[model samples]
Target: MTPPPYMGRTFPETTSHYLTTGTDVLDSAGVEAALKAVTSKGYGPVAGAQLVLLCNEREADLISTWRRGLPSREATADEVAADANAVGPTAKYDFVLSASAPAYLTDETIVGRQAPSDFNGLPVFDSYGEAFVIKSELIPAGYVIAAATGGPNSEGNPIAIRQHPNAAYQGFREIPGAEQYPLINSYCQRSFGVGARHRGAAAVLQVTEDATYTAPTFAV
Candidate 1:
């Protein structure tokens, strides 16, 4: 048999990259503006509520950054509301305010534990998973639930009249104290609605929060 490529023989290792273009061409500032606005609007409703920072850095750090990022320009607020409108209630939020790698979660109002110096970066957890991390009462919750056949990847038709009760319950498993774990490849939590799964809601908050200077980042 042929030796594996590396130190002996070699075989081609390749992957394809994709191109994604928005409906309109936006400048760097425009892009930044949109991001700022949408995130700002999101906070408006949950201004004082505890938030989680689920990226690489501390959750508290992420929360601080989000609040500060909001008001630097007045347009940010509107931009946020606009994003909400565009996404509708059922989809995910547009950005990630937490640190990268291992998909860390930060409480919007609290500071997290110190990170180790020997931190291994989490690369696989990117946007697609990021898009799925949502807030509120998610149908099936935000997380993927085990299929009703009690099997993996067995998500059956949600609309069938005889759907399994667990189809929805098994779907959204919460990451308890999610703000502390290193960034996991996950979806963005944007609201309090439980979404399609349940006949009720989880904890849906309004779409706005108040802002003030948070520690770490200087006022923009």
Candidate 2:
């Protein structure tokens, strides 16, 4: 069988907060609980450590300067700021996938929907970008990925960045509910399509940080 289509789009997800808001500091156990709650939501299979590295020890201005010079970090302050500078800008990539297959379907929503499933058949995709995130429900090290759709909402579709048919995807320029639909800007060749019309996968999941890092792609 061609496998019945899946429904809903909330991959299993886990988050951590580097923040502390209590008389007592957040310990390992308490932090773990917060993480579990987010993960349990089926947002994603995001795994990473969240540490309170005590940046309070440093001065405010120096914090930025020092952190900027640090060795290996995911995103730069400028990079994150720039991406959000202009709204409604699309991005480029090697490929994108949606991980919320049979992963997350809350009671009311799942009532008439198909169970979520993954290419691995295990359900849930874990491939998030740790770089672009400035803040997350995940702890300090908490970062993960969930395959998902990207494109105009009206089309009920996602655009694949790189690979096609299965890996690469293109857009039709008209996204239903978008404030403005962009004319077909061929960022790249279409290696993939959706439904019988395009003869491609009905869905394409995107890994926030999987592809080219030059341009950052944020997830839902």
Candidate 3:
């Protein structure tokens, strides 16, 4: 079957950042946890590593806070003083994918209700040009490779199941048990292998409810 409407939109730009606390105010352990998760699988030479961070609202807030608080490594003495009073830290990362994205959904939400009018009040979505962090839980259980072009071999290809063109997928049909409701079934029938040639290219670091960021306590 054809992909859903929400799949049409392009993903946010691929960006990278070296997550650092720079001070003990934020948990260094948590920062390390996030860092290890992203680089755990090592980096990809061709793809340059696309690390997608999946976080909830609270986690996003914490990350954004840490990002804004960290001191800039490249700032000269004069430049640093010019903006010493800035409240929020300068963001050098890609945009965080909010709940409005198409992939952010539970299985129950998709099958039960029709597409909603607004996804978390976001009627439109564009490439997040600031931070690489994405705030959606619907991403697949592994590293998510962002789509890209111009690379040797399959350096930037999408992660998909490859199948024959004609017999790639099955058409939509009705189910026997759910005759009353308007449920269509267009599942995949053709056999295909996982289309990820460069697994290292795509990576994700997911957080659970119990996850914590342990910052160091310093003595005065």
Candidate 4:
């Protein structure tokens, strides 16, 4: 089923920093060091890894909110079988995990810390009879998302990323005439949107014993 419409817009930009240097400085080690720092942090309207992490945080929020609005229950064997058959017997649920979950699963004191064999060398754990993928970088610390997978088509996926058909309006594009010699210029832009595609395809579980759910925080 098509997901209900829940619309919003955001234009989050990264912090901007500038560097001033003479022509001699360009060839110096200080310039190299500065460039390395910028690459690690971010520069000019884009926060590099920070931006990606923020986007992932927002996406997780959307998925959690969307799932919470739907009915909650345990999946029956028949329903699981149907889901498997619906997509050529490859369908299954995925438990996307983040932060403390991974550490907890691997803790020596808690789970015997035997270092469970990796799933085909991937970062996935299948000890719970379902794939628990570690996504600490993308997901918040306390949440685990159980999502249905291997649906009939693109829309079968719980989340969708929509982009304009026109190439000019799709990915990051650099603005012209923003550069001058000796001093460098940097600019990039993109257009895209994300939303839920299938209803009843996912659920969110806050891994907590508290009376109410308290959102976790991460360092950007």
For lDDT, the strongest prediction is: 3
Name model 1 segments beyond 4 Å from true. Answer: 1-65, 68-99, 102-110, 113-195, 199-220
How do these models rank on lDDT, best leading? 3, 4, 2, 1
Which whole-number lDDT from 0 to 100 does residue 44 have in model 4? Answer: 15
Candidate 2 colliding pairs, count: 44
Q: Mind giving the per-residue lDDT tens digits that candidate 3 earns over 1-220?
A: 1111222432233433323333323332333444443343343223364333344444444554333235323343554588875332344432233434556543432222232223234232222222144445443322222322223344453355455566424333333344564345423333556675534333333322223322333355
* Model 4, span 1-220: residue lDDT tens: 2223222422224322222222211111222223332333222113211101111243334322222123222333655687853211111222233323344443323232222333223343222112223234566544544444442344455468889988787877876543464234655678889887643344444434343445567686
Query: How big is the RMSD of model 2?
Result: 21.2
Report RMSD (Å) for each prediction in the order shown: 23.2, 21.2, 16.0, 21.9
Error of 2 at 112 (Å): 39
Q: TM-score of predicted model 2?
A: 0.17
lDDT of 1: 0.25
Model 1, 1-220: lDDT tens per residue?
A: 2212333434333311111112122112222332222223332113322121122222112222223223312334455677753321111222343233455555654233322222123221222111212122222111111111111222221112333355544433544344666356545332222223211101121111322211222233
Clashing pairs in 3: 27-215, 68-89, 93-130, 93-131, 94-130, 94-131, 94-132, 95-131, 97-134
Q: Of the candidates numbered 1 and 3, which has the greater lDDT value?
A: 3
For residues 15-35, could you state the per-residue lDDT of candidate 2 as single tens digits?
Answer: 222222121222222222333
Where in model 4 is the C-alpha error above 4 Å? 1-122, 135-137, 151-153, 178-186, 210-220
- Rate residue 40 of model 2 by lDDT: 39
Count clashes in each candidate, considering only residues at least 3 apart in sequence or on different chains: 59, 44, 9, 0
Sliding window of 10 residues with minimal summed lDDT for model 4: 47-56
